[model samples]
Target: MTSSLFEPEPGKDKEASSASMPPALKLSLEMGPLVIFFVANFFGQWLIDHVPLFSSFEKPIFPATALFMIAIISSLATSWILARRVLVMPLVSGVFVLIFGSLTLWLQDATFVKIKPTITSVLFALILFGGLLFKKSLLGYVFDSAFQLDAEGWRKLTFRWAFFFLFLALVNEIIWRNFSDDFWTNFHVLASTIFTFIFLATQMPMIMRHSLEQPPSDKNEDHAD
Candidate 1:
C-alpha cells in the first residue's frame, strides 16, 4: 500500500481502513496539487495573455499562487471526502500553503509562498528528530500499515527520513534563493518528488530484512500442534 501524507498510527484509528482509497488513486491525490502548481507557474504568463479567464490578476505569479492555493485546498477536501480522514503530512503541507499562499497574495510577494516548502520540511525533520530523542520510533507510526519492521529497522528508517527531510529543507532554500522563480517552481515539483521516490526504493532491502513475517518452521510447528 502506498503511504499517505498523514499515516495513521498503528492501532489508533480503525476507521482508516474503510476510508483508505486505492494506492494509485491515493498517490494521484497527493501529487495532483503539486503538479497543478508547477504547471501554473511554468505557464503563468502565457495563461494570462491567452486566457481571458486569467487576465483579471495583475501578474502571472499572483494568479498562479491563487490557483495553487485553491488546488491545495481542493486536494485536501477530496482526500477527506474519499478517505474520511486526513493524513498528517498532507494536512500540514495544506495548512502552510493556505497561510503562505494567502500572505503571498496579500503582500504581493512570492517569497512567502516560496518559503512554505522549506518551513514544512524543517518542521517534519524536527518532529522526527524530537521523537528519536525520546526513544520513540515515530516513523513506524507513519509506515506501520505498510511495513511491519523490527525496532532497529524502524529506528534506522526514521533516522534516514529525518535526515532526508533536513536535506530537502536545505535544498529548497538554496534553489529558491539562488534560482529564477520558474526554475525554483519546476525544481520544487520535480526534484523533490524524484528524490523521495528514490529514497523509498532504496529502503526495500531494509524493509524486507525486518519484515514481521513468520518463518516456515514456526508455521509448521503451529500446524502440528
Candidate 2:
C-alpha cells in the first residue's frame, strides 16, 4: 500500500475520499472566486486609491483580472484539498482564467479577461459536439459521475447542453462587447447565474425521465408494502 501527497490514506475508502463535499461548502468553493472577481471589479477604484501598488492601473478591470486569477487558483486548490480531486469543469475554467487573466494583466488590456468566458463557453460547446461525433456523451464525464442516464438520454442531453453553451458564448460576447464594463460585470455575476439555473430547471423533466436512481416516492411505497 503506497500513497502520495494527494492520494487517500491506505485505510480510507476511495469512494468516501472522492465523494462530493457538502452542498454549501461546494457552492462556496465554486462561486467564491467569481464573487471575489465581482467585488474586486466593483471596488477597484477604492483599492487603487488605498493600495499604492495598484496605482499603475487606470481601470478597475485589470486589477480585477489579477485578483480573479489569484482567487481562481485559491478556489481550485481549496476544492482539491477538500474533495481530494478537482472537478473537470472548474479545472478547465481555472486553466483559462490563468491564461486569459495573465494575458489581460501582462498586456494591460481588459479584452482578454472580458472574452475569457466567451472563449471558455465555446470550447465546452466544441468538446461536447466533438464527443457526439464519436457517439460519446462527454458531458457525463465533465460532470464527474453526478448521475446516470440511458444512451439516448445522454445524447439528447448532450445536444441540449452543447447548444446551450454556444448560446451562452453568444450572450457573453454581446454583453461584453456592446455594454459598459460595470453592466457586463453585473450581467456576468447576476444574469449568468439566473440563466444557468433556468436552463438546469428546464432540463429537469428530461433528467427525471432518464434518471437511473429510483425515486424516493417509489422507495417509500415499496417500504409501505
Candidate 3:
C-alpha cells in the first residue's frame, strides 16, 4: 500500500526522540502517580515522622496521608517534565488525591484515602459509558498511541472496556466497604492486576480482528518536514 500512515514523522526523529520506548513502558510512566501513592502509603508514616513540620502527622494513617500527597505531587512533576504536556485525566486524579488526601490527614480518618479508588473508578466508568452513549470511541483517545483501530472497531472495543470499568468499580467498592483495610489493599493491588490482565487477554482477538488492515491515506500524512 502506498500510504504515508507508517512513515516517520517529519522534523522529528520519533525512533530516537521518544519512540524507542515500548508501549508498556509508556503506560507504566503514566501510572507513575498510582505506583508512588502505593509505595508512599507503605512507608509514609516513618517518612512523615522524620519531617519536622509533618512530625505532627506522626500518627500512623495521618503520616501516610501526608506522604501520599507528597507522592502525588512528585508524580505530577515527573509527568510534566517527561511529557511536556498537561495530561488531563491524571491531572484530575492528582487533584483529587491532594484534596482528599489532605482531608484524610486533617480528619485523621482512613475513609478519605479508602474512597479514592472508588471515586476514581466510578468516575472513569461513568466517563467511558457516557462516551459510548454518544457513539464515540473514548478508549481510542486514551489508548491512541498504544494501538490503532478503525471506527467501528474502536466503538465496539470502547463499549466493552467501558462496561469492564464499571464492573471493576463495583468490585472495588464492595471490597473496600466490607473488608478489612489490609485485605482490601491486597485485592486492590494483586487482584486488580490479575483481573486487568485477564480482561486484556480476552480482548486481544477482538482487537486484532477489528484493526485497520490498510494504512491511513498519504494525502492526510503530515508534511512537517
Candidate 4:
C-alpha cells in the first residue's frame, strides 16, 4: 500500500501510533544514534586501536561516520520492530544519514557528513513550502491529531515551521564552517534539540488560539438560547 510520509496509517489517527510509543522510549530511540555518533567521534581511535575491524579508518571522523551509519540503521530497525512503523521525521533523517554517511566513507571526506544536517533542513523547508503551494497543510498530516486546528491555523503553523527549518539550515552552515569538527559535532546533537524544543514551545500559544475542539453542537445550543 502507498503511504504519504506525513500521513497516518489506515485505521489509525495521526496520534495513535505516537501515543502508543512511550515518551521516554521514543526519546531514547531518537537520540540514540546521535549519542553514538558523538561518542564514536570522540573515542574512535581507542576503538580503532582495540577493535581490529575499525583499524582501517585513518581518522576518527571516518569511523565515527561509519558507526553513525550503523547506529542509524539499528535505530530505524528497532523503531520499526517496536512501533510497527517508523516515524516519518526520524525516517527522513535516517535516509540522509545513510546517504551522506556513505559518501563520507566512500569519498574519504568528512564534508558530506558534516553538511548532511544543513541539506536535510533545507529539504524539509522546501517540502513544507511546496505543500503550501498545493494549498495543502501537510504539517497537519503530522500534527493534526495532536492539535485540532482550523485551516488557517495549519497554514500559519506550516509557514512558521518552514521558516524555522531555513533558520536551522543557516545555523548548521554557520557552525560547521566556523567551528572545529568536534564543536560542530556537539552542536549538531545538542543545540538542534534545544532549538527544536524551544521552537515547539513557542508555537503552543498559537496552536491553542486556533484550536477546533469545541463541539459544533455546543455552538448551536448557545445560538438557540
- The lDDT of each candidate is 0.78, 0.77, 0.64, 0.79
What tens-digit string does per-residue lDDT give for candidate 1 at 1-225? 564555566545535643575556666777888888888887889888888877766666777888888887887788777776575667788899999999998887889988999999899888889988998878865576567666767877898999999999999999999998888888899999999989999987766666667453433343211
In model 2, which runs have C-alpha deviations exceeding 4 angstroms? 1-14, 17-20, 142-146, 214-225
TM-score of each: 0.83, 0.83, 0.75, 0.82
Among all windows of 10 consecutive residues in model 1, the one with the lowest summed lDDT is: 216-225
Index of the highest-lDDT prediction: 4
Sort all candidates by lDDT, best to worst. Answer: 4, 1, 2, 3
lDDT tens per residue, model 2, 12-119 = 444554464554665677788889989999999988788887888889887887888888888878867777666567778899999998888888888888899999
- Model 3 TM-score (2 dp): 0.75
Residue 172's lDDT in candidate 3: 87
Per residue, candidate 3 scores C-alpha lDDT tens digits across 178-219 of: 997656656776687789889989887666665565444632
Superior candidate under TM-score, 2 versus 4 = 2
Better candidate number, 1 or 3, judged by lDDT: 1
State the displacement of the C-alpha of residue 38, model 2, in Å, after optimal TM-score superposition: 0.9
Deviation in Å, model 1, residue 147 alpha carbon: 2.4
* Weakest ten-residue segment in model 2 by summed lDDT: 2-11
